[model samples]
Target: MKRLLIACETIRNEVELALKNRAVEIETIWMANTLHDSPDRLRDALQAEINKSEAAYDEILFAYGNCGNGLLGLKSEKAILVIPKYGDCIEILLSETDNLERIRTTTYFLTQGWLNGEKTLDIEYEYNLKKYGERRAKMIMNIMFKHYKNLMLIDTGAFNVEAALPRVKDIGELIGLDVVISQGSISPLEKLVSGQWDEKFCVIPPGHPTDYDDFLGISLSKP
Candidate 1:
């Protein structure tokens, strides 16, 4: 079946890795990672893409989680919509890990794809430092990261985790959080691409808009 995969660029590396060697006839559209900052905008952007491409594909896959309800109203008039059953990309990547609930509550996760995004933590820090001055920037950062005790750098095997550590460590120091490394899986993405839409995914039929109820009962915790 012809498929269109619309995904956040924040997980571009993982998505690409998941599609490698796959026999499926799929096309991909990568949306800006920064769009995640505004759920409303993300919703609008995704809807626009779906409207434009729905008629041409047998199925449309979203490499995203609920994303603060960004996917709430998205629907395809002519194609099935498949999405991960998680709160966000972080949850999707760490889906196979044990203690996921505890890890999400106390840790802020990062990946190379995330670090390379336009609105990465370091970029935000620099912007704040420039606009609000160093003192205020530090204060703002501290407040923003107060809930996180550790900055987890997840190695999804799509990029060099070793090379990213220095930058991750610097960001952790800037936010007064400890830096830790963990392995992340792209199995969820792989499953999506390979049509393994099991319990970990939400499969919506044509003309059926995704609802908040679709995500209910999924164990998700936002960091």
Candidate 2:
């Protein structure tokens, strides 16, 4: 089957492993540059690649669970596949077992702490990010990992990296269900501007969890 691998962060290793295991033929590799707003541009570029591919693949899959990057605009005549983001997949895997309430509680607590501004690494210039700043970012990640570890226990009955990789590995497995894949990529700012990806792809980046995003203070206006 004809395949496309859209490279994105977090899932690079997983994608390679899946391709190796499934023996899927990768017809083209589209790498989007997400340096600045490049993630947004990358989504557009991927869409353009899809149109240009001339329907060569019977199906397409988004390799990363983080397909929220501006992809809602893409409507394919062929089968389109998506792997839910890490958070969603974790929620799903947790659902398969018991303790849904506990998991929700843990996620809630961690997310809440993040919104309140917890910091692990005391980096300077953290306030420049326009979001919760670096302090809050690390806090959110730590909280996520804490809850993520607990969630993994539902699968492995313990908390460890072994549990975590499997969670990511499962995402790759989901992508394998389809023939074509859409994923995210990293790029230098220069490559992003020259590539013109936004003409086609759309980036649908998810917001910080409702309770965790301090940046919710930013004013949003409908154009």
Candidate 3:
């Protein structure tokens, strides 16, 4: 049996789902910095965790973002990173005027297909396509389409789509893709090698708070 470390940008719901249905023993690191804004604090915090359990896992896998702490000297034997592209496009398609329930169903189907690595033949299949249409949906689809075009599906590593948006949107206001594209880059292969890869131990303490959620607990399992 191969031991693997799965480092995530936020919660490990997707990975946990995968683990429940797979055979591999997955050790997850549920990083609290979903937005990747507080590099200094996140770096300091993860380094401390690495120090305590530096001999339990064989490789590291980043479910989302770049795992900024990788640059902080964490050790790992091997690492895999999963980046999910695409937003809630179905919501954009369903005209609030359209039969709200049916539109919701269509939107849910499309988004779920995208999430589960399935392809949608026509991007505008059940969408209104006009009146409610805008370039935002197209932009999102183009990026997501290009990202998954030729990639092989890896283990399901999850991220907080809603949470990471603000900082990314802020970065977008800054320098755009040339800089933000690397937001989820992986690094520091050796420092993340703390082998204590238990899915139960993925959460870290001293989390952050946002207007988005009340008392954001950083632990893997919600408090």
Q: What is the C-alpha RMSD of each candidate to the true structure, in Å?
A: 2.3, 15.1, 17.5
Sort all candidates by lDDT, best to worst. Answer: 1, 2, 3
User: Candidate 1, clashing residue pairs?
Assistant: none
> Candidate 2's residue-wise lDDT over 1-223, tens digit each?
3444454432333344445444545543535324113445755676676666536764444443223334334445553433233332233223244555564543322111111223311221243334676566555545534533222222212223343444334432322211111121222111222222332222223221112121122222212
Q: Which 10 consecutive positions of candidate 2 have the poorest summed lDDT?
A: 177-186
Task: Give the residue spans of candidate 2 off by over 4 A.
Answer: 28-42, 77-223
TM-score of 2: 0.38
For residues 1-223, write the lDDT of model 1, one tens digit per residue: 8899998999988888898945554789989987888889999999999989988998999999888778888988899999998989988898879988888888998999888888888899999999999999999999998999999999998899999999999999999999999989989999999999998789999989988677876753333
Per-prediction TM-score: 0.93, 0.38, 0.30
In order, the Cα lDDT scores of the candidates are: 0.89, 0.35, 0.32
Worst 10 residues of 1 by lDDT: 214-223
Error of 1 at 61 (Å): 0.7
Rate residue 159 of model 2 by lDDT.
Answer: 22
- What is the per-residue lDDT of model 3 for residues 1-223, given as tens digits with 9 covering 90 to 100? 2344534433244445445444445565565533345555655555555444445533334343223323223333222212221111122122123454443332222122233221232334224235346465455445544423121111122345445445434432322221121112111211123232332112222221111122122112221
Q: Which has the better TM-score: candidate 1, or candidate 2?
A: 1
